[model samples]
Target: MLEDAGGHVRDADDDQMRLECGVFGAWNVAESSAITALGLHALQHRGQEACGIASFDGQLFHTERHMGHVGEAFSGTDLVHRLPGRYAIGHTRYATSGASVIRNVQPMFADLEASGIAIAHNGNLTNFRALHTQLVAEGSIFQSTSDSEVILHLVARSRKGSMEARFIDALSRIEGGYALLALTNECLIGARDPLGIRPLVLGELDDAYVLASETCALEMIGARFVRDIEHGEVVVISGKRTLRSSRPFPAARARPCLFEYVYFSRPDSVVNGRSVYDVRKRMGACLAQETGVDADVVVPVPDSGVPAALGFAQASGIPYELGIIRSHYMGRTFIQPTQGVRELGVRMKHSPNRQVLEGKRVVLIDDSIVRGTTSRKIVRMVREAGAREIHFRSASPPIKWPDFYGIDMPDRDKLLAARKTLAEMQEILEVDSLGFLSVDGLYHAMDAGPRDPVHPQFTDHYFTGEYPTRLLDREIAEGRNDPVERQLSLLVTA
Candidate 1:
């Protein structure tokens, strides 16, 4: 089955990491909630668990938050009608900071002493546990267990005179990657972390200013791309249609997540001045150059693998074929709520095309391998379809470290590449051969030159264990001799 743009297929979920959320905000737009909904729809690939929109209709703030796809939650309901406004902010969440539940759904709203504010955040907070512990000890009653709720509490406790100042104060106290959008009675605010670990873009539509996680969101609402919000910068769009900008955090080298180019972002979107599709194609070409194999046909794993497979075919001068067909009607497997059904979902999601694979040497191109479970199933399916030999290629390097920055990655023990050698991985997957892109090749694809050993250009600890920000939670937990701590130590040592 074809993976839903709104959510990952159930079986694929185990093998793919999930981005935390996608955020969108607009100032001075008519029917702002509807427009924000469209923006969230375009950004559905970023998160698929829950969706919410909060809008200020000149007098009062209206909100609609529900657990489901954006279209399911907004299209068939009167939820949009209740959210009439000129300013708005929205979030589509894929639980990373908290458990997947309605209480964790965002565009988390707060009615502070100064004014009401609604925020949609995209990136995980590395110091979440520390901040949460401190805030709770200070008598702050959290509405949800989500790390995002800490920001709301911080804003409420800030002694700053203006709401904007309070917002900036709260942000400065927090650490780690964030691309957030906030809506207040007077203005819409957007900000990015100092290191730019996540993406945030600015756009304009008619008299309105738009802020979204990806350019595709802006394009969906007929907005013109206005350059990315610089790292550490804060932008405020007033109800009067005036736009102001500032830098709240000290200047730092920007290191946007490299995974955005590999798997997280939409192929149609542009992030950090590069086309994601173009970058993925380059990654495929680079992988082909590193390990070109003799094969009768180059087949994409489907959906996410299409562009890369095309590039691999172009580079290797092999015929590209759709050897596997995906079903579009299958819902996410994790939602099955039963182990047996969830396991069965893997077969329902995809089927091998015997005519294309029969007696042919096939090269399979995939974006990445997380657990090797799905890859094993795919290889077996292809083999059963009469494939004589199967070679697997990953566009990204082996992911050895876990991501704490908004990506819901498995623990170190569950990672196939983290625990297994290349030969072991090939043996486990039962493939003829397996190859992965090198870290240097990834940098070349990004056109960022070779990665600097001292200071890497991107947030890529998943491949290289050199983390960009402090992992406060992990550090605190590492002192104990627990299994998790031991695993973390092994990762560090590796």
Candidate 2:
């Protein structure tokens, strides 16, 4: 049952790449709702637009979704009372495949003949549009526009007798990168996509089993990390906490998203047995090796840029300093600001530190430049703070192509790197010099050897446009299908 709750929605209006969602689930744990809430807190960095939790109190499923952060949505212990259960699952959403509305907030629940299930998904299904069209033609009603809801309808309409069978049936029919959590009355299930383009970790907390998008979530709830849920693997944790595993898809090389290291995963988290923080540091060191810049100080853009800047400074033998201070409290849309004030967008989140930047040749390091709007503003801010010269460095390679998996990125045409030459980008950002880490450098930093031309070690498609899965939705949308299929699609819409 869905519970109406109050929350403060913070809209995102930035150039940073956004992960679609984060999923967390706990089985056979005391105060499972509370445990799930704690895990969601750690995964909140993955998504911030909406959050929800669904619990099964042995007999009934209780759910509460709010349009905001997990901390605000599930703030009080009263939530423990409202969602009493030892089996629970939660999701934090940013909406890449659906509108950011309360209705689309998940741990999307459905009552089926086998059981009541709540599924929380991270990443997008490339075949969602086609499947959605087919499902609608079959008279299945959908509550949310989210591609994830299509999974529910598929499972519901499956001919399979068991819940696990039906769930696998749904997964087999969908295509794309996804790490999913499903909580049913009998068991809690966790599965990762065939290529492992996304991430999910298995953990054990006392007598209970846990699953989350990142290991940081396991750490947050003091769970012992057992292992990563392997590519194309499905793990089912029974009500009695007995665990079983299956691989329902063909074996494939794991190609986890490279952005998890470059920007997405929490620095403290371990992804695929690699420390995210250490990998980012190596990325900076590689970038420094590739494009060393002479400067008075290496200044990070703050937060996400700090680790890479430290690595750059160390590698280049340049001193590191805090050239920009970020305000944590600044909401994207705090209030209606005038046009002039809106134009100073970066100033709301970041302020120049004159003491560090004044009269110095500054080397500004950032994770990556998306549209380059924020980079230009930050460059102007540093210049206004009396920096004599500014050289810009991006730890990750220029993102020339858009992502279709889960990262919310602008189209290829809108990408600054996609359209502009290196010199043009330098001139546009008004930086004395600009350099981006080479794609090979990124691979070296991740300790993945060189990127394979035929089979990449990681999903570096945002930079390389070598997407691992077929983009069925994009193909249909771009009218790249057979004429017969196009006619059928048009008729379906009509």
Candidate 3:
């Protein structure tokens, strides 16, 4: 069973690492809201809980936020017409940092002294709680609990002369792995964090400038990929169809999240100049070389694990087969109010093919195992199909630490790898053997060389516990900061 943002038990949580939000913005384009809707459709896999679009039609800013998929909300021409404009920004959210309420849905708009600003953010802010506390103390009335709103308040309170200056001022005050798109009266703006932990790319669609979380969105809208917005860069695109770039933060080597190549990004996307699909295949090839079992057939866990399983099969000389078939007809938001119904939904989600699994030593390949509940159930289903032995493999390294950036991972104690040894996890899953891709092997797959003790290549804290940014909220929550120190730091940053 899945839990909603309100802590209420729901149906069909996949027990995988939840995706962060996706953001898209268009400047100086015809039917920009429609274009943004198309981009959101391509990025639907990133976040499904809610979607919102904000557009400026010269005189007034029109906004619409809805609960559910982008197709459900914006597929109709009538709804898209409601958001008429040549300048727009959109967001698809998964509630990584806020409750799944309508108020929390993003493209969060605020009316500033200079101009109305609509901001869509794609990552969690580490210093959010501290900033929120200080802002509230200073009389900032917040309508939403989302960390994205904090950015708007910061921009609203800035003493900067221009809208772009105010936006940069807000960015300089916040710390975390973030990719942001802002819609103002004068221009459309995009910004990446100092570490480039989240992705934001620049694209061109005729006379318009596009900013999206992934290149796949650009492809969906027939936008030409210009380049990736550099780390600590703020790009401003005015009505003249020109881009002005600036870097407001200290220079640092980029440390993009490793999970993008492993799971989060769409397979079709090219992130940081590397193909996501190719990276996953290389990861699987590396995994096969590291741990190969004598098996008759290699089977993917279906959908997410397919590319990696194919690479594993090719490298290990084992025949690849569709041992498990997933039901694509099942709606993601289908209601299952009870635990029994929810468990039944899980069973209905995936089924084993007896022809491939019966009387065979099967090697099961999955993207990663978080809590291991879903993995155990899949193993049981394969066993019921008469598999003689089940050797389970994870394409990515063990997720031993929780992510504070954006990916919605469970606490350390709840993670299967964090709590159990290999033998212990194998016993718990009732599999013949279980293996995970080593951390070094994963780095090699990305062609980034060995992991550096002083400065890592990627944001691999989930596996190595080497977080790229400060976790101010987590530290405060865990009582690791003194009250005096917390107040002093908040005063300086706030």
lDDT of each: 0.87, 0.88, 0.89
Instruction: Give lDDT tens digits, candidate 2, residues 107-177.
Output: 89998877998999999888788889878988998898888999999888888888998899888888899
Q: Write the per-residue lDDT of candidate 1 for residues 166-253, one digit (tens) a residue.
A: 9998887787789988899889999999999999999999977899999999889999999999999999999568999999666999
TM-score, per-candidate, Cα-based = 0.93, 0.95, 0.96
Ranking by lDDT: 3, 2, 1
- Give the clashing residue pairs of candidate 2, or none: none
Over 4 Å off, model 1: 1-13, 76-80, 96-98, 333-343, 480-494
lDDT per residue, candidate 3, 153-265, as tens digits? 88988888999988888887788899999999999999999989999999999877899999999999999999999989999999668889998777999999899999999
Clashes of each: 7, 0, 0
TM-score between candidate 3 and the true structure: 0.96
Q: Candidate 3: what lDDT?
A: 0.89
Candidate 3 wrong stretches, greater than 4 Å: 1-14, 96-98, 337-341
Better TM-score candidate (1, 3): 3
